[model samples]
Target: MWGTSRWVRRMAQGLVLIASAGLAGAALAGPTLTIGAIVPQSWPSTAEGEELVLGMQLAIKTWPGQPAPTLVIKDSACDPRKAENAARELVAAKVDLVLGSWCAIGIAPRVVAEAGLPFVSANAERLPKAPDGVLQLGRIELYIVEKLAADLRAATGLRVGGRTSCWMNFEPVLREQYDAVLCPVLGFDKKRWEQAEATFTAAHRRPFTASVARGYAAMEAGLAQLRRIRGGKSASNDPIMTIFGPLPPTDVPAQADAMQLVLSPKLPKLSPRDQAAVTQLLQTKACTCLADNSCSKPGPWADQPFVVRGNVPKCPTLAAASPR
Candidate 1:
């Protein structure tokens, strides 16, 4: 019996050693990239923050890779101090990249950049001039403002101007005052959007919003950078430059398109004549003369408040309607 006990003890020790080696191997084989996210977890923006995190999670879950990236999330609580603190925590955790949303707007980017981590401002409308380490991912307000002005001028045949406002606080009364309003349209492929919606709804039991879309796009960009690094295809040895450098063109269409002009849904509808005029104007082809260089000479439209790029469809109707 004593000999049998000794043999059993030896067997147990051997098994323990093998298990330890397996665990160490697994740890060594774990994910190479760790992504950190700073988002609001408390206060008024809690819902948006949660949805954004969910979007990031969805992106990771859907990634088709051998070793998936790890995600570490910190809460900013929509406060400047908290955002800074969250960024510091992520830095201490040694994350490879950092993504920030609404609450992380101002200080978080600076903190992450200073820590030598690439910071992606997922929802910033505008970013101050900074080093390449800090980059923005979403549409800037300047584009929205310019697009609105151009659309209004094209449709109304009148000189129009645009100013930025808090879109979230936009009221129907303001729509009544303005001749045109710009609205965001999900620029994603219909099938992809449906899939995302279904997945988001199932997970969160709530409708997906633009905040979530931003989060999803942010993660997608981060993973793309990681892949480039792993493949040794990065343009620069510095990860920050590699991440913030001009992206190579891909066949995939943009997930979000430029803002689209839409009539306000305010009640007490417009008069019949006004409504018809508005409808006709909207149906008219967008003025692409400025974009396409089809115009015989430069016009006032060329003096846009902000720089606009890409060719628009030729605007035959606007040309014909223009006062020659």
Candidate 2:
């Protein structure tokens, strides 16, 4: 009896070791994930691009997971062909995810979508309807434009009244979206709008220009979504709905209609830690205001239909306004 009992125990131990080995093998064979980032590493938006990469790095470092992802950074040179080629290379690399700067390179979204990969643009000025598995991390300016027109009309009582104007010095993507979405919806002509460019080369603590803020916000929001998905807590395929849909608003109304009107909240409330950090960054390092220097200064629009801070128009006054 004693011999039989000893033999049974030995067999059980052998089975346990085999099962453990099988489990370990399965773990070793588990899939690994790679993230591809396409950005302009040189010229013009280079500073903003670098900030974007830093944000991505921060996200990866603070990821709430075991195995970290592999990030493959590709430079698109802010050129359409280069952006397309970068997308192709990422596809060839079999990257599972892609993050890109679509504002600088127009062809990025289309190429990424054609690859049928999950893509998120950290900044996009002219987005078409989101195809499945594609998302934009930054705020689309469509609503902002609409609001500006409405607020201006309400403040000035000036109707579109069959008037046409040219939009000058605007970014290509911004111009396109304005022509396509805002003009049609708001009943205005942006095809020939003329505006001055605002110069604040000596302005200090202006880290959060519209582009840089978008980059930082995109990284924070994207990383939060990724963490939720990685933890198997994501309930929806819509990235926006899954990550930010339920977040509460963290906006503070200012007496200046410009703050209330022009500065629409682009992001939902971030995690408590992120909220404090971002708030400080925007207030200190970044300019939460719009890029138009004249908007904040008293102008003809000030007496027409715009909010004024001191002598500066608070809300953006485009068409006759200047670009930052």
- The local lDDT score (0 to 100) that residue 301 gets in candidate 2 is 31
Candidate 2 lDDT by residue in tens digits, 109-215: 67777887667765423354555555664333323445655554443333311111211111212222121112211111122111100111122323323343333
Cα distance off (Å), candidate 1, residue 61: 1.5
Error of 2 at 295 (Å): 16
Residues 268-298 of candidate 1 have per-residue lDDT tens digits of 3556754554434433333434453534444
- TM for every model, in the order presented, reads 0.56, 0.50
Tell me how many residue pairs clash in candidate 1. Answer: 0
- Predicted structure 1, TM vs. truth: 0.56
Question: Lowest lDDT 10-mer window, candidate 2?
Answer: 192-201
lDDT of 2: 0.46
Whole-model Cα lDDT of every candidate shown, in order: 0.57, 0.46
